[model samples]
Target: MYKNIKVIAFDADDTLWVNETYFRDAEHQFAKLLSQYETENKIDQELFKKEIENLKLYGYGIKGFILSMIECALELSNYNINQKIISKILDIGKEMLEKPIELLPEIDDVLEGLQHRYKLIVATKGDLLDQERKLEKSNLLHYFHHIEVMSDKKPTDYLKLIQHLDINPSEFLMIGNSLKSDILPLLEIGASAIHVPFHTTWAHEKISEKEQEAADYRTVSNIKEVMGLF
Candidate 1:
């Protein structure tokens, strides 16, 4: 299927290493910390809402999440949230930022196997510094021809990237977990994509059943399965 593909772009967060799991764990910690003011379910809902609202102001990654937690806590507490709780929230964000990069099963093997045959690239969205740190820690930096830390993943962004790489849309293939961010956009622009489902996905990245059904892309059970597609 990828016989004409010259560039294989990868999404670095959950696709390459553990990311949303840490966010989920942090959310649980946050709910417990603010439980005095609201139920865990309510806290989770409010936090998700706040994160979405703050996406424009803070963008993505741990720092923005931490800020949203603080904002939610203040509103939930009616501006009476304790300083200690705020400090605890900061600590949680710190721990998340400091967590070691844990690569998913077969990530290295897949990269190693394809690096020589294709122009591998890291096309992901997140805080630039954090993404760079994870990529460095992953120790697979040497494999990619380029690293694009996108602010947003849209068809236009992918078009710009394709131009920069000097490749036609038909020569590009993107692999990621999110259908909304990774697969649909690439497919919309005449590029191919492989959806490697992650065990956990943020609500914002979820797509409708009809959208998934209509998407003209291949779906794989795991990242390693991508090897068979090419």
Candidate 2:
């Protein structure tokens, strides 16, 4: 269906590899640290919800997430936080930075198949160091002709990337997990998008109702389905 697409841009995190799994695991460990102060029912689930809500206001990234965990810890512990508990939370944040990058099943094959026919670019939003490290570790770094690591995925960012790659927006295709960050803005710019939903998306990346209704967007269950576009 997308054979005319000359440039195919992919979102790195949950789209090409396993990212949400790390965040979910870290959150579970974080909840465990708070279990002693407040009852499991009150502290874990409520705090997890608070953190998710905070993500919309503060946005995603280790810094904001760590801060939310710290706030939750302090609140639950009644300002008498244990040093070891604090250390463990910080360690969880560090572990995310050091987590191994494992690409989704069939991602490599799909990219390899399309590389010959179209220009591939990776457009991901996150800390630059983290994103770069992931691309390097995944061994899929060489597949993309361009890499855009940004703090946000606004329409301007998409336009800039398309311009930088010298491709018209209509001729480019974006495949990603987040409808908010990946699909909507690109679609607003007249680009095509394929949505590959992740089971545990960060709260901030969730799509709004209005953005969900716009443009040439297609949804797939897995990354491999993206190959059908070629």
Distance from true location, Cα of 15 in model 1, Å: 0.7
Ten-residue region with minimum lDDT total, candidate 2: 55-64
Give stretches of model 2 more than 4 Å off. Answer: 1-3, 39-59, 208-216
Q: Estimate each model's TM-score.
A: 0.99, 0.87
Cα lDDT, all candidates: 0.95, 0.83
Per-residue alpha-carbon lDDT of model 2 for 1-230, expressed as tens digits? Answer: 67568998899898899998887888778878887787756765666676677866765566667877888888878899998999999999999888888788899899999899888999887767778888999999889988988767899988988888887998989899898888888878988988999888776567667757755589999888776655
**Hey, what RMSD does candidate 2 come out at?**
2.7
* CA lDDT, candidate 1, residue 97: 94
Instruction: Give a tens-digit lDDT track for model 1, residues 1-230.
Output: 78999999999999999999999999999999998999999999999999999999999888999999999999999999999999999999999999999999999999999999999999999999999998998898999989999999999999999999998999999999999999999999999999999999999999999998888888899999888887
- Superposition TM-score, candidate 1 onto the true structure: 0.99
RMSD, every candidate, angstroms: 0.6, 2.7
